[model samples]
Target: MAVLNEEQEMLRDMARDWATNKSPVTEFRKVRAAGEPQAFDKGAWNTMAEMGWAGVIIPEAYGGSDFGWLSMGLIVEELGKTLTASPLVASTIAASAIILGGSEDQKSTWLPRLASGELVATLAVDEGPRHAPHSCSTSVSGGKLSGTKAFVQEAHGADLFVVAAKDGLYLVEKGDGVTLSTRKLTDQRSHAEVTFDGTPADSLAGGGESLLDDVLDRARILTACEMLGMAQQVFDTTLDYLKQRVQFNQVLATFQALQHRMADLFGDLAMMRSAVEGGLQALDSGFGVARAATIAKSEANRVLHTMSREGIQLHGGIGMTDEYDIGFYLKRARVLEASWGSSAYLRDRFAKLGGY
Candidate 1:
């Protein structure tokens, strides 16, 4: 049971209240119906940025709140309850990469912009189906980058791209030969297959290949935090439906078998909470973050997958219908499971990290 400090609890409360009032589940459904990846209200995004969510993890010098990973996770958990869609995850992870490994100049240049929501950035790493960081097919030549990055979240709308290429990590502008073609995914967010053909890029002066490993681990942990939020939402939604939905002349929640199922889901959710919180603590405490992040992400992936599936299944026919909100959650969960890395992939990495 990880406890939130005063500031953290305040931030959580703020996020929960804002998400409930400004960007509720109904708003998300409306956005999905409009065929937009960003179901989040633009006004709500601006409000969040004003609340310092955009800069929650950034240093204060960079116009940020510098709240740290735990605070960021708390906000994300609240956002997940509504399946809110914003560039929060991408921007935070990208900014963290710069903060952890970028030169002072790089941090000064990008961190403030990211923190202020003046720029939206995403990590472009994957070239194919596999989400392994070492599997980068994107290469660089003569200060130029050339490769395709598929499934790039928010690519269609991002202002900057933090691309991982063979020559190291490069920040490339979104123009010229950098072609972004949007793909409609199940999660209803705008993803794209980004092709960089000799695009002009600036290398992070201080960060080399080693930074790639660090960035990926950080991204995985951040993603796990988001998944934790998504899983909790699914559980809550399913629980609410069970209590209200009548079956066999009684509420579904009244059945002992169903109670056991909910208990199992609660246990899984608890485990995910432990893993994510532990990973955040490890990262904040300057402990060995790679192994901790891998374990957290792997555990999150497994539990989220199970919770999403069971959530929909328990909802029965209504779950399969697009009109129902549980279907949206299921879709988003599936996408998140496939993103970063699948359960099997992360589990394998975790096993190797243990030297098993």
Candidate 2:
């Protein structure tokens, strides 16, 4: 387990309580039932902002607590355990891009609102099914951006979008010249396919390929943390089921074969934890972050893939039903596995980065 300072531990405990008592998996179901344009509760988001979650990484001068990425990761992991749908990660990523490369004027204008959660933002990188960074076809001319960005997370109500063009990232607001077509993902969360035609954009100061890459690596680390939470939830839920579910004159947990399978999952869980912690530490200390992020996301892709499958297998037929929460993990696992970069994608990236 990762050792935390007193504040980090308290943040983790508070996040856990919030997820359990307020925004459990059922909350997602409720939002989905209510339909589009209201994918998540704005009130809940405001509550999170009040809790200082939105500003976890922003500097205090910009109206944030400046708690750093590790603290943010802890909160995200707890939320992931319940499959809570919020814009914390997406907004954080967007804020980071600004923090790292934004002009003084840009920072002074955006950071405070972002910290207050009065403005929401997300990154738009993919133009298709694959996660190709260099192949971006988005064009920029005369301070206007024209292109299509797909798989934009938390875009339903985002105030700003950090879009990747052929050259670099451009800030595009949600207004004229930008059209959004909403898509319902497998996990019942909403994403947008945005088309920007001559949308006016503000270029980030000192922004280039390297800054974009750094933002992506940071996003991957945070995402890996969430996947860690999801995997842990699946394991814990499956274990509880094993203990309570009875068949053939004994509890499932009593069977040696099932116990062995769970034991293996336990080991995988430990590795996942270490990978996530390593990523966080690397980012915090500015040491080996690229390698650490690749490792963390790759481990997340593998562990979630395995645990989600095993959770369903152990639950048998009941797991297949919509009523069962185990099935939700499988759907979310598939999306997360595909998002940013899959295990196969990250493996190739790692090899290439190593000059192999």
Candidate 3:
């Protein structure tokens, strides 16, 4: 088990308190009801930036806190508790790509802005729904990109886009032949079907197909950390509910059958935590990040899928109603499961890792 240091623990506690007090479930409810992706409270976003969360994983030279991947995961978990809707994950993935493969000039221009939250960026890699990075059909020619990227999270509000095209990785600004058509997704945040019609773009010099693979690997692990947080929160919330909600003259938590179920959930959560921590360490150590990320993400997906459904099922009637906050976690779990790569997709990748 990877135990956090004092500083990391403090950071996690601070994030937990902030998310609880400032961006609670009620806030998410308001944002979802408003039918706006930008409905994420601007004040909260600014606060997160000020707290240095936006720059948690970016290097210090780029105006970031440089807290490393584990620190980044701690904050992400807290955000999941509130079902906070924002471009944090998308921006982090984009920033990591730029740092890992972009030219020095590219880093100088974008990293600081991204770290400071002055610009929101998202990576466009999914051409269809299969989560295959190599299957990208978006083409680049003469420094221009053309194709449509579907299910782009926060695309409606992003200021910069790090797009993956067939020729290589390209950076597309938010205008000039770039059309972003916002699509209302089930999770109720902003997603878009982006059409690039010969959009002017800047290629990431020296970044080829390997860059896409690198980004996907990092993305998978980062997303797994976030999912770990979400799963933990759902488990904790469900456990709390069982303690208080009485049935048959006793709390539901007292029943041996329910106790056994919670015990099983505890075991799964522990496994997920270990896997995600290992994946994060592997990424930081420059180990086999792709395989480790696939394992972590695949396991986390199974854990969250089971926990989310079980959370609602255990809660009985209140779980199905929007009046309760548990449903929000369930909805967010489904969305996160489909993001980056689905469990089915990751399992295939894991098999490839094992040479099966």
Number of the top candidate by lDDT?
2
lDDT of 2 by residue, 1-356 (tens): 87899999999999999999999998989888888663788888999999999999999989999888889999999999999988998999999999988988888999999999999999999999878777799989999999998878888879899988888888888899998888878887868899999999998757565888888999899999889999999999999999999999899999999999999999999999999999998888888988999999999999989999999999999999999999998998898888888888899989988999
> Each candidate's lDDT (Cα)?
0.84, 0.91, 0.86
Candidate 3 local lDDT, 1-356, one digit each (tens): 68889999999999999988988888888777777655476677778888888899898988998889888888887888778877788899999889887888999999999898888899898888657677888998887789999888888778899898887788899988988877775677878889999999988866555888888887888788778878888999999999999999999999999999999999999999988888888877888888888888889889999999999999998898978888877777787788878988888878887999
* Residue 227, model 1: Cα distance from true site in angstroms: 1.5
Q: List the residue pairs that clash in candidate 3.
A: none
Task: Give candidate 1's TM-score.
Answer: 0.96
What lDDT is obtained when candidate 3 is compared to the true structure? 0.86
- Misplaced by over 4 Å in model 2 are none
Candidate 2 residue pairs in clash (backbone atoms < 3 Å): none
**What is the lDDT for 147 in model 1?**
95
For each candidate, give its TM-score against the true structure: 0.96, 0.98, 0.97
lDDT of 1 by residue, 147-238 (tens): 99988988866878989877678888888988877778788887999999999988875655578777877788888888898899889989
Report the error of model 1 at residue 89, Å: 0.3
Could you tell me how far off, in angstroms, the CA of residue 30 lies in candidate 3 after the best superposition? 1.8
